[model samples]
Target: MADYLLESLGLLLRWLHIVAAIAWIGESFYFVMLDRSLKPAADGDAAIAGEQWSVHGGGFYRKQKLVGAPAQMPADLHWSKWKAYTTWLSGFALLSLLYLSSPQMYLVDPGVNALGSDQAVLAAIALMVLAWLGYDLLCRLCGFREGLLGALVALWVIGLCLACTGLFAGRAAYLLVGAALGTIMAANVFFVIIPGQRRMVAALGRGEAVDPVPGLRGKQRSVHNTYFTLPVVFAMLSVHYATAYAHPHNAWVLILFMAAAALIRQFFVVWHSGKRAWGLLGVGSAILLATFAWLAPTRNATSAVTPNSAVAAPMHATELPAADTAEIQKIMKLHCTACHSAQPSLMASAPKDLRLDEAQQIERHAALIRRQVVDLRIMPPGNITSLSEAERLQIARWADTLAVDPAFK
Candidate 1:
């Protein structure tokens, strides 16, 4: 009952996080597009930097970018900070519930690092905090040099990616990096962007010449957040694909993925400014293709041979071995049935409704099993059941046989 309740709460938090993130990202993108698409003020007002006209939902709207304080402060000004706050809050809650609450299962991989559950949770929290601090420091120190600052920020993210992949399970590492980036985004809003805007508003209300520096700083952070959107979204979604997180060179894979997402985002940003940079899209596609190639499995000639071939060898590369059904069942019972059974001991219900306790169910999920256990090697997450490489190889061999024979199914 407790597991069910926890799962239910996790689902609710995830829904809230997704909804808030969408609202925040949509507003951010719309504002960026509006900024880039703006033209000179029609009346040649020196105080107005630019202006844009648009029709939305059957209503025409004109938005003007003010250089400094307007003559009077507008009442009932809407603030966009709450979307960011809600996203971060809900996301952190979900992370605590699903991962930190059971760190050994999701956050820590003994194969990667032997961190205790409590230590792993603390480390994860520390990483998010440190990520914000490091990124904020970089912006403060190098805010004047945009190009150099961008390069430095990229290096900082790469460092975080390496640190995460080295310290935690692949799934956790990817999500941690996402969480770190999310923390940076929300911090930009809460600590820098929103505060700067509020200060400018206060100055305007006091009939003083509003400082342009605060507005400039807010714009800079807002632009940075836009560029981070795609990469952060990719990182959050990547946990679903074992091919990415479970790759032997997962850190490099993650770095490449982030680079590709950034490049693609840059293309859109450039397009919004009335320019076409096809090269950015081309390069991003090439990087994605390269990553796909890197993650592709290598087929071995010996994989097709029967396990009983030691007695007599008469096998061609195309001739697949007869898979040992008993051995395959035995392996699944040992490593998979714990969490994947109908009445799971570890959880209230079978994860993903995958029950491996029976032969029919095993056969039904053979391809999924092969992908998770053989190709990706991410089953029994954190190697909680002590699944060995040899056992994985046995599953791989069994899977190869299934491809050539219909009887196995």
Candidate 2:
């Protein structure tokens, strides 16, 4: 696309996505904490299950709540539902704009399949839907709401990470996983959660007793959303560490990362719920993540070089002719360094960690470019980089022209 159009569209929706995400996540975190901190009402006289008092912005603020009826409903009760829904919507728009419609180079890994955009998109949607359906079913199972549910769901999520990441590129896998989570979240909101809340509201409107079961179901889904949040964030941002997605056994690495992200999230949840050191659960989760990481095949997190002073393989400067190197560098600086450089040095900015600053950096990342841009057309992002079709072909051809993975340890 023309730079003006790509830049214009990316700029606009990205801003909306950011604003919406802040609202969604901020509200989610606050409510989860609120519910957890709520205590049993002494004498059962409190109108709400929880009440909190805090000083913020240098003033004391007290909040009150209720299990259902508040004696009488407030004239103005703000609904926070749209924050989450809109955030997911904006994110979906961004995903489609940047990753779906553009060339396959940025999101597709030809290593998986040299697919046309139509086929790749179909695959992406199918996988995301499949993941959500599987997870929803797991939650709806007969015994899924009790003690074993958490463990079962966790394992099921792990299995999903392994299966889906195996079929797609690493960054693509990570993204689809995030998308799957978003879908589940939206489904939870629309199907189970919203309906349950509506039922409660209707009962209240009709002067009928609001049963706590709907509230409980809503709470269950909300908790699931909280547990799912961290890994979703991690997966959304994993494109930066191409290495994570580029590991030799890539799927296992995703499984490891997801587990690690979830474990870290759990720590916060338990801590916030006022159980600071639930040692057994915490330590057990820690060990589980550690075990997974130990099993992942890690390349140098940044470079192909080994930790030892000995190089992985001798450098072959002659293999890339000086002219070719200069041309490749020129192409990168012209088309990519804008948003992908060390400082990005272009526009207001791009996000972090996908920086490309030097020649060695470019060559070292040749396979990635080929996989993401050349073969998959997954980068230069939505053609926002204004990389021409010819340039795309050249870049891929250049990456493939390399004879071997000389940097492999």
Candidate 3:
């Protein structure tokens, strides 16, 4: 009963978290698109101040506001909040359960770094805190509304992301960066935004005027959050791919994926904002190419050598059993030759090492396919290629048929 209760709570929490995130991101996107699409009012910048006009969701929604502050408090004025706070709170809980405590498997990558699991988790937390602090300091020093601030923040984030990826497993690094980013977005609300609104409300209650600077700051931070949503979503998913995480140059690949997603987001942002569709189309094209580059697996330095022991080794030539050479060749060609081939006699992606171009190479790494396709369910990631379960089962069965001679096993 206790276990059942815990499981039920977990499911409910996840559902709520997902809904909240959707609301937060959805509002963020709507505001971004609306802000960009807003046009200058014909009546001049009055009726309020520092305002814009837009038509959305089958109606014209005019969001006009005082350049400074309203003269008096209206009986009913809706507050735009809770979305940010709830999103942050829920995301924090999820991260804590998924990564912060599970240092055993999620935080440390023995293959990549020499650090122990405990050391890795500590490093992750420290880095996350540092990233948030550094970004906050940068904002204060540079001025959030300043154009250079955005570019500087992006550059700094990329640097920190690279460092984290190099230090930890690919997924942890990405999540750490995400946590930091999420912190900034939430802080913008809790620290900068809500406080500003409070001040405005207090002024209104006192029948006085509020300042615009705080609103500007809030808007700037809000815009930043909008741009972050798409890329962070993609980064969150990238961790599941062993090709992306365990690859020799995993960090570099992650960087490319982030940049590409950002570009794609920008492309859509421009298109919805009514810019030249071609420019947006070009960005879309670039995103596709970038994704292709990231997924198109290439061999890494560490994967070159096969271990002498079959237990830990990526299968090798000397270890192959007396399986039907012709049948094995046919299976590899039909099932894997599409992506794992160097020349890729079929589709795209040679996918980080393990070329299925030859019979010997296939035999050497048959066990890898078995593990990835059968055991891991990580290959054909996102089911992009739709590899059938039968194919995966066939590979696994063939692998099982291999002779378990002590010398090889």
Give the candidate number with the greatest lDDT. Answer: 1
Candidate 3 per-residue lDDT over residues 291-338, each given as its tens digit? 566556432223222121111324333344344535666766766676
TM-score per prediction, in order, is: 0.92, 0.73, 0.70
| Every candidate's lDDT | 0.85, 0.67, 0.65
Off by over 4 Å in 3: 1-8, 42-45, 49-66, 298-316, 319-409
Better of 1 and 3 by lDDT: 1
Q: Which rank order by lDDT, best down to worst?
A: 1, 2, 3
State each candidate's clash count.
0, 14, 3
Flag the better candidate by TM-score, 2 or 3: 2
Candidate 1 segments exceeding 4 Å error = 303-323
Error of 2 at 26 (Å): 1.3
Q: Cα-based RMSD of the predictions, in order?
A: 4.3, 7.4, 10.5
